[model samples]
Target: MASSKPKPDPLSIQRGDYARTLAGPLLLGLGRMVSIPLQHWLLTAHPLSHFGIPRPPSDGVLELPLVGAQPQLSTIFLGMTATLILKQNAWIWGYCAERITVPFAFFGVVVPAMYECLSALVFSYASSNPLWRKEFLYVGAAVHFFAAAVELGSELARARFKGRIENRGRLYKGGAWGLVRHPNYAANVVYGAAYGFAAGGPVYALFTGAFYWSNLTGNATPAKENYLAERYPEEWEQYKKDVPWKMFLGIF
Candidate 1:
């Protein structure tokens, strides 16, 4: 008889896991360093004006005067970078599995760096032009911050629950998980939408939100559920009964 292949260990450190962890902070940090100056230039210098990019008249719907907007934008970027770094560290140390491949690590680094660059560009343009009311910016920023908190908190809560000796091989259905099966994924969608809204307006927010929602629901969430079902068949079924919602509470 042929020997059975070894089962994968979630706790086992994989070849690229450490590199992925390191790359996340490095790329995000670099992006933050670049974004601040880039945004400042876009907001103050109007460097692209010669290219015929016209600025729209400010209608004062949460219109942040240019002077105030620069400082606020800087603060937003700073907060976002800090939050991302913290979240990255939390996932690596607390929740990440051996499934983090080198390609995935590379993807993670490139995407976040690109997002930071794009955000700096778009937000600067929107701030100058005053698209879709200014109040939405404040609202979006607030929602983004809130979603970040929830994401980080939920991840930490689950990590802590998993760390207990008695809880080995058990499922965590407490904290934010009690509210939704995948609170981190839910928060991810919210934050993406909120960030897009803060950057460009409602249309951008809708696009970004839909993107995250589809990616999570169609891919990440289902894969995770499948893994959990295989690993903890009894617990997962009961947990599903207890918490019917996957991401959102009332919808989905």
Candidate 2:
């Protein structure tokens, strides 16, 4: 009887990703925390609050309390995402740079703008109304952080495989990469939904989730796959055969 190939241990490898420099991840995490909040404040409270002027009664403004359970919950939820971004930066900057490239400027410019606009609007609409129950907030935060964890795992896996193979140019399939062709993208979509819920409520989650889906499927995934296919034809084809879904499990 032939023995089956041993599965790679997900936690067994380290490529000195953190030893290089933590500045990048720390900055990124800080940026992540400020990104949406700055947008939210600018569109809602900043003009008045910054200038010490009384906020005029307006139906279109976000009126989240200065301190409350809802705002606190939002902060905690968003904070976890920011923390994960910092934690995962080592894997992303270390491993992803080898095989990944900015396929288009749209992702760098347009998508984030869209997300900010959507989030700002959601906050404006939902901040006053207590649309999120405590239970729902707890569940949403768990899902968000879980997806962030998955993203971190995927990056670590890629870095580990790259280290093991000693091939800087080929696709690495050691850790979470084996579970899905694009685990990062899958996790992003899941986290987006969680962010949406935290930002606004269920309605916001729907909008954010749809945006992530479109961004991943319509723009990012195809471009990445095409580049990989061109760069590593035989390996890419074999990879597709082994891992069929572009993102997530049998869903995509």
Candidate 3:
């Protein structure tokens, strides 16, 4: 009989694993950088305007009254907002890549991004409108602050969500998470609403808010809870008892 092929060395396999461990994070960083220009163009430039839609009057300038008075400030804020969006997009993409299962995973990744992209596109047009009142800028600023608060709250929840350490996972039940089981989704709700507020119209508000709500209630929240339930059955039971609502306070 032919001699059996030599067994692969376990140490070699371990070394390969070690070498490839940083690949995910590295690619994530590179992808974020590479995507910046495209995202900027999509959000600010209104590339689809050539297809019968109106574009911003000029590049990188919001056509709104005082906002257009100082183009640089508006541009800086726009860039910052877009950067935050890209960062969040990368984070959720990573989450879906790692945690989501098939048959539903594709939907999970695409839906949330579409909601955000729609909001951004609407805001681009809304900001480009010269008809907005000066006071509405204050409204936009206030909503921007609210969105920032949601972001900060979600960050705090992430700090508390120390997951699967040494294969012994611990459920987060303090801070923002204490108020709602899905603080992250709540943040996304606030974010979506803020975008609507910034856009400043009844139609945009309804569309953006509905899309955001559907993403959380109809998509992300259920998928997240399902995974949480499977990953930490006992802890998830207790968590539900302690925090009844999935995305809202006193109501879901």
TM per candidate = 0.75, 0.65, 0.61
Best by lDDT: 1
lDDT of 3 by residue, 60-137 (tens): 345656544434323443554565545555554443224222323333434444544554465556545555433443
lDDT of each: 0.68, 0.61, 0.56
lDDT per residue for candidate 2 within 155-225, as digits (tens), equals 77666666765676688876767768899999989988887876667877888899889978997787678
At residue 251, candidate 3 shows an lDDT of 78
Off by over 4 Å in 1: 1-47, 54-70, 94-99, 127-130
RMSD for each of the candidates: 5.4, 10.5, 9.3
Q: State the number of backbone clashes in model 1.
A: 1
Count of backbone clashes for each model? 1, 0, 0
Clashes in model 1: which pairs? 61-134
Model 2 misplaced stretches (Cα beyond 4 Å): 1-71, 84-93, 98-114, 117-121, 124-131
Clashes of 3: 0
